[model samples]
Target: MLDKRRNSNSKERIDLINRFIGLFGKQVIQSVAADREFVGKNRLAFLNRNEIRYYIRIRNNFKVFLPQKNKEIKASHLFNCFKTNQFVYYNKIVRINEQLCYLSGCKLNSKNIKQDFLIIVSFNKPENAQEEYQKRWQIEMYFKAMKSSVFDIEKTYLQDIQRIEKLILLVMIAFILCYKIGIYLHQINPITIKKHGRKAEVFLNMG
Candidate 1:
């Protein structure tokens, strides 16, 4: 757990993760995916230097230097003519923070118009970025289940960093167990798909 006073940016989080995994010298990470909060020039450069594959989403207005164009352009500008739900994968890679990366962009047909653009920068397989980024939503759903529906963790109102870490660790343990049980339960009897296009709830609730 990070101290409350410490202001952690993408670099710090990535460094922390790298350090943790460094203990296992031969560990191999398939790829890393993160929201815009973790997207920055230094962070991207660091990942590139380490040859770490990544799919980091960026805001529509993020500027990248296009070598072909010999200028910086907002991500959305490259796909300005794209229709809703239309995805564009640039043939040539671009430079952001002087790090070479590919870009895959989409104009999502979501209710929130302002945030419709889903732009992802990656070290490879830009065409697969949009779909890969969708999996992050599943992680968000799990956190929501812990913080509200299932564990109600927010009510604890933790302040001390050590106490918060302990609480989060316990919650994480429960979450892992419940998620595993949920998977097993689903294998026995599939979950019912509700009208909202998702299973009624995590199968753990059925257990």
Candidate 2:
């Protein structure tokens, strides 16, 4: 039950939701919201199972699960308990600080604990997460190379949508050609080039 919030009023956004629904089916609930904070601040959904609860928080003191008992409990109560405990029991240890944990029971000739433990810890530096996120620049680099180096997309004179699309397709074809040629050259015999002498030979002949 991972929840994702989107501005659903726009036709583009609605179409995106429809695409997901077509693949995953109607059981995927659709909720319209003005902004991400609305979904985070308001607990508009419920935990269907007692075994586990999943939620996201926006405002500082947001409340979550209610006590099944007649006595009412606020979200702060659960947060306080979790903060104090510093751990949640999932029949065994499940979550530690920021890391997820796993424990194995004894049996089947195995040791008391297995090697499946996972620990997640966050850095205290303000820019650590941002730096990690910035590592995605490789994707942007690929796009830039495709549009400029491989496709010469900026050189295209067409303004019509269909012609622009055809130019994009041609650019993709050029990239594929370059990639295949690179792979083929990499698989050629290096020994044959070495015997041909340094002046005439390609330095990176691969085989």
Index of the highest-lDDT prediction: 1
Model 1 lDDT tens row, 1-207 = 666565688768777768866885424776788888778778888778788778888888888899987999988887768887888898898987788999998787777647568889999988888788787887887787777667888888779888988998988898888888878888998889999898776534421
lDDT of 2 by residue, 58-112 (tens): 2323322222343433323333333322333223222212222221111122255
Tell me the alpha-carbon RMSD of every candidate. 2.6, 15.9
- Distance from true position, residue 91, model 1, in Å? 1.7
lDDT of predicted model 2:
0.36
lDDT of 1 at 103: 92
Off by over 4 Å in 2: 1-141, 189-207
- Alpha carbon deviation, residue 152, candidate 2 (Å): 2.2
Candidate 2 residue 156 Cα shift, in angstroms, is 1.4
- Structural similarity to truth (TM-score) of each candidate: 0.87, 0.30
